[model samples]
Target: MNRTELRFALHLIGFLDSVEGFEDGMVKLRDRRWLVWHPDVMAALFRHDRDLRHPPSRTLSPLLGNRSVLWLDGEEHAKYRRTLAPMLRGTRYQALIDEMVERSIAELPSGPVGLAEWTRRLTLRITGRILFGVDDEELLAAFTRWLDRRLGSRVRTLAHRYLTPGTTRFDPELDRMLLHRAETAEPPALAAFLPPEDLRDQVVSLLFAGHETTASATAWTVYWIDRTPGLAQDLLGDADLLEATIRESLRLSPPATLAGNRMSADGMVITPSIYLAHRRAATYDHPHTFDPTRSPPPPGAFFPFGGGVRHCLGKDLALTEIRTIVTALLRHRRIHLNTQRSCTPQLRGAAMAPPPSLAMVATCRR
Candidate 1:
């Protein structure tokens, strides 16, 4: 590994807003390693997933375990996706998600709340119920502790990558709880559909991927809505506009900056930078500005979920949860930003997250 390049990547991923002189197109980071952000290149790479393979197992195996879908490729990955895609897309699950969102919203604390923390809990609660088939606070809290330790900071993220057997104190027990829940869960629980052999890793990966990324995205969307004058009120009436606003929020602060790294047949490593692609002026008018009124992005120009057959299986579920929470919260309460200063993205594990200090105060709507 090129130590200097690796360090630069880690810093950029952790603190995306700090990046300067970022350009579109393919950037060669090291011999045989490249970063591609140009919409055309991203489209090409995503279109031909078979030509590219995932990063080495050691990179993610420690945190997600050996059998995580993130590590699978070719037929194995395709089969896994086929099994899970229908469940996530099922209308039956949408009803369950709406119920969970309403319940979570009812529990939202009155007065000032940290946006990141509040959303994290909301998503964890929602995701836990789906994956574990129960709302066990102890399990949720333990998982949070474990996740925070692994991806709380740039240092921790790097160490987790380079260190041997990167596990927190909550392991073994948490693993057991997740696996047991998945195996025993009945229909309608997401865990019930998961394969038994890969139960542990799959459940862990789903919880982390399902909640963490959505939590960050949800928080960022709320932050932007509060920042824009009259936008929240407008959203209450216009469903399409509400989606557009969320899309804009995603464009500004994509939860995952780089789609997973892909290895080419010739030993070249290529990664599509969603962050960069979304910022191209050609694709987005006044790219840096947050304007939901702006024209919709072209097909390849916008990809909060990575492109291709490898696109996130939980995309529909995530959007449903986000839309439900945002719609319910807006309808039930009027929330305003606690600080005048804007919030920026901070990398939390694999997600680009809002800082914990970003807060808002909510008052029930009369």
Candidate 2:
């Protein structure tokens, strides 16, 4: 990691003991001025008075699309969120678990396999089916390529979004597929409020968010579980332990490490660091340790999917997918990390993914 990235990681992991005493819980970085890491203050910033602040749309618009719910705030954000909420509810999420399990089982290799890569592919397939209603191999391949290119760099993504013609429009066949699925599947009520363009952008945004973050979380969960002997069996036997395992994995290594930068209407900048907040000693005992049995961090302190009104719309879907993947894996196989080398976190695009070389060996459980 570069110096800046290393510093950020240290902050996120609570290794920087010196930061525990910044005045008002604010630290200045570069010329941008204030960076807030305190859990309580950051939580309040997210939960209260959201109307006065908005995410950094200028930076994200190119990738998420200008009309995406991620870029909207206040009444506009609420309107879209309400329309999309039903599709991500527990029942809807539960309905997708069987398919998730099937996919994970089908994709698992016989020996050692890169857990992160496999999970990314698994999540991409799952989200592709859910969002587009079809899992055409060619379509998924194309989407993965596009996502890889766009997420590689912010400058390049902006250039591509602006310079490339028809970049804002969904593929014709994919759009038709989604529309057809909407006829039978539970679709978001976006058409009532948004134009076709905005609706398309919203669907695309959801697909990106749903696939990437869940993949990272699932990989990390598997990595941690594999590291601890008997934990996988414990997770399979106890439902609460399974839930705690997922929560602790997210707390330790949230995919979306930082919340989108929020700029106040009055020209003040409020940077909400989900990573740092998760590591805050005040919010968690032994913040760096991965203890599934630990009491859950209080509400706002552990926000892997973020907080407040703009919290990830796919939070339920992501959690369900992670639970389903982990449960299925454990039930079918005993998971162990390849002990030849240590696994670490690596920044991939917008998420902190498991190291590319990190592999898990899964043996069929008798």
Candidate 3:
């Protein structure tokens, strides 16, 4: 790898003491955790996923709640998936997504704006309406405030990571407030679809999981389109190219850098690296370049939503939201990167997003 590529890879992987065995398909970190990124190994792991179990997450439980599907294993995890899968899959929410995208596009802010923040708010609003069945601005704003105060600060985030266990991160006051708002919402919101017994935890998990990742993906797609000459115009004219562009963007910079950590009954711990898996030179021609025109990737090679039975539940919904937002923005406004700002990859909680300094200017097309 070239110097530039090596630097990008490091940012994507975050901190690791050694990559000495990476070329051999798996590498052991300083913590003795193994990350496997090779396509064959990853595929095999997923294929035999029945033998693997999700490792409970201490850091996330307090934030996402103890019962959150993120840390659940065995039948508990499958039950959560079963309850939520039907609602997320298929064309059930496509119209709702397209409507939200158009509304967000129609109200585009004037002048240069932070693209990451812009997309975050947009997705937050959409997620709130669809998931909670309410568009209470006060509630959404309060939720953001709570999360910002806790996870937004670099100092607090570090302290939460190293200073204490994950369960310590939960805020009871905020949790109660969020749950009350969700419970009071009228029927038809996706929140109603969740079982009431687990409503609070499920609401917290869905909202937290749904918004930021989609927003990050949207921001990254816009960045790629802005940097590639005439790409926006090409996307406007062809639907397939727009899809390809979104796929390419996800492949290049998936919002979530890694899949859930898994452990075998035999005590073998393995983590799948989506970032590394997507960038393998063997699987992608010119892996570092953001080329949307490349031919389709092989089946097991491009599992951005992850592989196996535990693949992301929001796959179709996320793609639809991204396609709608990108297509709508390109159709209505001309967007350009604010080149004065850095566009480096930075970690935002669990998601990898364009740096906060990354700005873009969107003006209406005459």
Q: Quick one: best lDDT, which candidate?
A: 1
lDDT of 1 by residue, 87-184 (tens): 66635467777787778677767867888888888888887777666778987898888888878776787777777554532388888877677777
Which ten contiguous residues of candidate 2 have the minimum total lDDT? 8-17
Question: Who is ahead in lDDT, 1 or 2?
Answer: 1
252, model 1: CA deviation in Å?
0.9
The candidate with the higher TM-score, 2 or 3, is 3
lDDT string, candidate 3, 223-254, tens digits? 99888888888887798888889989999988
- Per-prediction TM-score to the true structure, in the order listed: 0.92, 0.83, 0.90
Ranking by lDDT: 1, 3, 2
Alpha-carbon shift of residue 240 in model 3 (angstroms)? 0.7
User: What does the lDDT read for residue 120 in candidate 2?
Assistant: 83
Write the residue-wise lDDT of candidate 2 on 1-366 in tens digits: 455434643333343335654535567644443567676676677767466566544334655667788878788778788877876664574756677677678667888888887888888877766765555667667666666666544345445544573445345675555444434444434444456667667766777787888999999998888777778767767888899898899988888766776766666766666677777777778887889888756656777887776688888888888888888888888787774535556654446788767888877888
Ranked by TM-score, the better of candidates 1 and 2 is 1
Off by over 4 Å in 1: 1-7, 13-24, 56-59, 165-170, 188-195
Q: Extract clashing residue pairs from model 2.
A: none
Cα miss at 96, model 3 (Å)?
2.4
Off by over 4 Å in 3: 1-21, 30-32, 153-155, 188-197, 340-342
Give the winner by TM-score. Answer: 1
